[model samples]
Target: MSGVTDLVDPPRTRRPAITSLEVLCGLLVLAMLFQGRLAALLDVPALRTGSTIFVAVCVQAMPFLVFGVLVSGLIAAFVPPAALRRALPGRPAAAVPVAGVAGLALPGCECASVPVARRLIQQGVLPAAAFTFLLAAPAVNPVVLVSTAVAFPAEPRMVLARFLASLLTACAMGWLWARLGRAEWLAERVLRRVECHASGGSRWAAFTESARHDLVEAGGFLVLGGLASAVFNVLVPAAWMESLGGQLLLGVLVMAVLAVVLALCSEADAFVVASMPGLPLTAKLVFLVVGPAVDIKLIALQSGAFGRRFAARFAPATFLVAVGSACAVGAALLGGA
Candidate 1:
């Protein structure tokens, strides 16, 4: 019996690792337990302001986010990869501009564009074209343009400058990526496809699953971004705008950075920038162009969807392209004011 016991191995038990869901649940429970304390802590004016900004950002973006995921799901379920491929130009280079133009039809904000772009790539749309659509959709869509026009009623040319700059930025980034992008830059998960079935019932299942998965994944990043944006908004003094007056180069750079930090919705950003005094049209154009193309919110979304490696490279490139495009177009249209 001793010899048999020595030869036999003992059964091993492994503990399950805690997942995000478990951590989230724990946080929720803690928050519930400390609700009064949390509310009391938010009584400070700055904290209250931050909370309001956070809530506003989330509320403003949620509808667009949901719309995007649904559209992504629809694409996954109904749009055949082959059909999409056939619809675009055979050559990726030629398809890029077409994709940028196609963006005009999608009236949703930047939050809405990210998932749709990812879905397009998953559905066999050329990466260059898909990327173009991603950048162009939020900036060039009619709703955004109309809002811009309304925001700057005195400067009708602002609308045209924004459209051209955004469109150019999108196409430029697409062309650049087509030339230099490596498949390894993207995470393995982004390229992997969720299997979709051909039958009607199966398609509906696929749509719901895809939408739910995307919403769950992207929603976390969106909340994180909103928190960051609120913090920055609270900490950054509005008085800085007065100091930047008469400083063209510095104003442009600062406004560009502010656009990234603020992460304002494209449809509403025009009004925000328009409200800021002491900024030239060129600086304002940079802010308008850069906000929709790349911001902290969009950065978080890109990092979540396409891994940090891709976002690290893509975000900076898009920023520079967007700024340059805005400057060039502003020069032509706004005459640098």
Candidate 2:
């Protein structure tokens, strides 16, 4: 009976356990095997164009990313968590604007803001204030504003418009969060993750680990965003952009959406927007404001740092507020659209 049962069922086969390294190696081998075919496919004009854009965006954005991670690592390692708590105003309302203004001090890109924001929250700074800094730091920082100036050499008001719109968005979001956000919404685990890492080892070890971890995590999302932008640049019809040229409201809405999709770094988005000369300044202003505050890459980082619940609520609210802020501020500062 046993032999019959064994024969009928056959021996259960054990599958090989695959480590991540093994899986990665296997993928590399597969890629190598198809290298010739892949090269030929890539030679198609659209694909070639897309690849070029992808590489260009990645190259342009990577330095800022690296700089941001370095700053983030330094914050994690050397800056005592208590320093932030002591530095912030006791009142949440007052703290929010202060945090937003303080963002100007950090010239790093949005990639650098996530971990620093999380660190602030974990270290006893008000969540709302930390969030404001997160939004404002990338958008209003000198590096970004200067880049905007350089990109729109002819229209320098773009610099001021971007700064005001972004600062307004950050402060509004911060104040809103203070009023409505529930502490329970943010995942406790995410907050603790950074704290746990920082608690152990020497400052050097912490800095290196924080920097390395942040780079790996943020870099992947940045690359994904760059690839998406490249694909859109190549595949989205020029006619689509042209159609919205003179339609102020529609142009603003579409550019806001593009900002969310492109996820371009604050330091570099100005250049991309500059290239689209057909779009109204109001629309391009919205793009500049929205990209740094909320984008595919920023959302990913925010979700990782602040939980999906927080990110979902925060990102859309910030987007709507940003568009309104940009429109109102643009009309006033850059002349009526």
Candidate 3:
């Protein structure tokens, strides 16, 4: 009887593991259940300020993000990979500086550059060149330069210094990556080729799907970064900057850090740094150079697009190079004023 019962018994089924989607839904339900408590908690001055910063970052970035995805989609649909390869130099090393220079044509902020960079990679452009464009588009564009000129009307060299420094950073990083970067560092998703004509889909269909996918994937990271930036902004007192006036090295480091924490839009960061009193010109230059190249917001976006491994390596390297370039350019152009 025992043998018969054992034979009749079926294997037990395992429970399914929870997915991110399910966890997100659970969080939404929890938030809905405790909306009053959450609202009350956020009423504190610090929390309120953080919330405001988060919202402002998101609002300022969304339009540019949307524009990026749209451009990415257009590239996927219309720009043949062969044409891109033909347009650029055959060697990745040679293409790097060219891509950096091409960035001058795009007037959008960092948010707009990420998707375009990713799309360039998808379209068979080398990672080094794409990365160069990513850094340069936001920092060296005409719009950013004009804004900087307006922000520091008396110091016209500030604009030139920023352009040269940022372009130098982009090209330097590109060459570095071309020499030493490993393909395995980037996520498979970034390198994977999407079938634009899958199931005989139209180019328009491909464009819509590609844009929608990027918007959904990258947008979540953007929000996450905004939250992080907000928390950092609140924790770092504004008064701390005023006290660092005489400490050149310390001021440069702190200002560089502030650039990452603040995550200001590139078009507006010049004005923001310009308004901050007491920091030396070198420190201010570092802030301008580093902000567009390696901020908390850009880090989050890079992690989402290329994977955490890539962001971890690429972001720190970019930050260091940006600081160095800014300091050198500032000394040469501003005479370390």
What TM-score goes with each of the models? 0.93, 0.87, 0.89
Per-residue error (Å), model 1, residue 2: 14
lDDT of 1: 0.92
Ordered by TM-score, highest first, the candidates read: 1, 3, 2
By lDDT, is 1 or 3 better? 1
lDDT of 1 by residue, 1-337 (tens): 9999999999889989999999999999999999999988768999988989999988898899999999999999988888888989979789999999999989999999999999888887888999999999999999999999999999999999999999999999999999999889988877876445587898998899999999998999999999999999899988878898777789889999999988889989999999988789999999999999999999999999888999999999999999999999988998886
Better of 1 and 2 by TM-score: 1
- Could you say which candidate leads in lDDT? 1
Clashing pairs in 1: none
Candidate 1 stretches greater than 4 Å from native = 1-19, 193-195
Candidate 2 wrongly placed segments (more than 4 Å): 1-17, 193-201
Worst 10 residues of 2 by lDDT: 190-199
Clash-forming residue pairs, model 2: none
TM-score of 2: 0.87
Ranking by lDDT: 1, 3, 2
- Residue-wise C-alpha lDDT for candidate 3, range 1-337, written one tens digit per residue: 9899978969889999998889999999999999999998778999889989999999998988998899999889877788877878989889999999999988889999999999999888999999999999999999999999999998898999999999999999999999989999999988987435443358888899889999999999999989999999889877777799878899899989889988889999999999878778889999999999999999999999999999999999999999999999999998886
* Model 2 deviation from native, Cα RMSD in Å: 4.7
